[model samples]
Target: MMRRLLTLPLIGCLGACSLTPALQRPPAPVPASFPVASAVPASAPASAVPASALGWRAMFGDPRLQRLIDLALENNRDLRLATLNVQAARARSNIEGAASLPTVGLDATHSRERTLATDATSRELDRQTGVNVALSAFELDLFGRVRTLSEAAFARYLASEQGRDAAQIALVGAVADAYFTQRLADEQLRLSERTLTDWRQSLELARLLKQAEQNSSLDVAQAEGQVALAEADVEGRRRALAEADNALQLLVGSELPGDLPPAVSLERQPVIARLPAGLPADLLLTRPDLRQAEQMLVAANADVGAARAAFFPQISLTASFGYASASLGSLFDPAREVWRFAPQISQPLFQGGRLRAELRLAEVRKSEAVAQYERAIQVAFREVADALAGTATFDRQIEAQRRAVSATQRSLELSELRYRAGLDGRLDLLDAQRQLYASRQALLDLRRAEIANRVALYKALGGGLHADSDDAAAAPTESRG
Candidate 1:
């Protein structure tokens, strides 16, 4: 009897209809294509591989940076946490998935009871033993409530997976940016120290001229001031370099490996792979955060379905087959056979408007999710556009700054020669030296910005999610676990 009863529900499950509303993806809220107002460089030819397809190894090119990114991926606390969250979400989804199925258990029980002796009654005792297989309260999901909740959980799981990918992308960019900053500081410190040495030599020359009455004490004092300024800059650069190192170490999540490939200079770092800004729709497939937001929207939509299903009847079943006897030896005897089949149905008649309120809440949440999804798309669009503009503009800005540095270097040389020949005053020589130093610093800063811009563009376009462009397209969208 119990077997027949369970079979009926299984057949019902096969034909049960879902109450979930048909899902319609909200329209993209951005322009069809990225703006072309100086966002892309004319010289930059579109790469065969899109940014999403270009992996970190090929884009970074620097072996040292590549190693650091690998270490960060393995050990970074934030990434570790994101990965754990994905696992947790997967477990929750599995739990919900199991809810739509029956849970069965084997049961064994033995009980003994005795009536205490009394003046008018003789002592008596009873013992019973039994074994059975039981089915617990398993929902039939006739209205798809359990199934919709399971769907919601599965969507949330996918969202968490995407979130992990996003974290990884951001981590790679952070490590690269920190590495460039540290290298820039090193370069700046070197320049400051070398300038200090030159100014110290000039101060000696000024003292000699002063002793010979060829120049005033003011010349010596000015040279001393220049040397002091360079010394101060050197110290500041040293502190900045230390802090940058600390930041990089934190990102890597451990002390940098001693065997890390040789460091590349800021100027020598490879150009990040050029990215073609495809249509805004491509972001849906490429950007993990966008995917994550869409998944959340999916979960929210599923929640609405579940809320709707709740207004219908809920059916569940509890069935068991077993044996019962007074003696353990006879527990499984044919004569002791017993079976039970219990089916239940519930309908919400009146809840003081609670059910209606819940349905309204679910609908409102779904609406909110749509807005959030669209807003995420808008934000991602802005990020990609800004990165494109940076890539286009930084090159021209870097080239112009290089020219200024070159001109300032020549001016400093001439001013030094004129001052030594007594044709120009100490003030003119000092001014030229100051201009040269500032120009060089500006050039260094701009170079760092250009490299960092490339990193930003790579990150913004959803690069660094895979190690090879060839593998990115094949990356798994669904959790195998």
Candidate 2:
């Protein structure tokens, strides 16, 4: 009877596995094409290469930078935690998947009881013992209820994996950005030191001219103030560099090693890749956050099926077959064998509208997932567009800034010559010096912006093509400037 009862649900599971609704990906809500204003030096035609396809090694030409990124990947606590989360999600999915099979376990029971002699009656004792391999209340997935739940768990597992990928992408960008920032600060500090020396020389010259009645004390005071300001600027840049190092250290989960080389200055950082910003918005399909959202949506859809299945009957089976004996010597006797089987069916009649509400809640959750997925796509599109526009603008701005720096430099040299020959006052020389310094600073800032924008574009493009989950560790690297 137990074998017959268990067979019915198993057969039902085989046939009704398709009862859960089929999964269909929703259409993307973005435009058919990306609004790429201009590709970064897009001389080459748009290649179908994804940013994820472009490995980090290719993007960062500096060996030191590559090492730092590798360290972050290994030691960053957040990234490690994300990997652990993926493992946990896998475990949850396995648990759900196991629900479809019966839970077979060994169970043993023994009891001994005595009745004390009462009113001249002799004392008597009774003993009972049994051992069985039992199958507990195993649900029969006739309507795909447990199966739907299991499917949901698997989808969640996939989402978690994508989420970890998203975290990885963000971490890589952050490390690269901090590395660039530190290099810029180093260059800025050098500039400030050079300016301070020039200002000190000018102050001495002003004092000498005043002693000869050719310059006033005010000129010396102004020159001294300029020197003081330059010194302060150097300290400020020092603080910035220190903070950048701190940020990088935190990302690496330790202090940067002494043997690692520093990154090149802003103007010296290599352009390793010519990113194809002209890819269609559909390239967002490569974005991990968007993929994660879609998986969550898929999981929510499965939940709806599970909730819907709740209104119907649930069938479960419990069965045990083993030996029972009154005497220890006869424990395994065939004549003392015992067996039992039970099959239960539960159908909800009423529960204060609980079943209906659960179904509605699952449906609402599905809707929420849909909105989240759409929003992720929109945000990604916006970032790509901003990076594209910024890349073009920075090129022009940097070119113009270079010209301004050159012109200011010439003006400073001529002003110093004129002041020494008594053709101009110290104020004119001082003003020229300040102008040149400011222009050079502006040029450095523009160069920094240009480099930072390129990194942003790479990140916006989904961080290049990566190997599929199966062989991601062994994927070949590819990219070039």
lDDT of 2 by residue, 47-116 (tens): 3455666677667777788889888888999999999999999999999999999999998889899877
Per-model lDDT: 0.87, 0.80
lDDT of 1 by residue, 1-481 (tens): 9999999877687547777787787889998998784654556434678888887888888888888889999889999999999999999999999998899999999999987677647877889998999998888777788989999999999999999999999999999999999889999999999888888998999999899999999999999988888888999999999999999999999998789888888777775536777888888888899889889988998999899988988878999999999999988899999999999999999999998899899999999988999999999899888877787788788889989999998999999899879899999999999999999999899999878878887887888899887798787654222
- Return the lDDT, model 2, position 365: 93
For residue 256, what is the lDDT in candidate 1?
83
| lDDT score at residue 127, model 2, on the 0-100 scale | 91
Model 1: per-residue Cα lDDT at residue 141: 78
Model 1 TM-score is 0.92
Candidate 2 lDDT (Cα, 0 to 1): 0.80
Using lDDT as the measure, the top candidate is 1
* lDDT of candidate model 1 versus the reference: 0.87
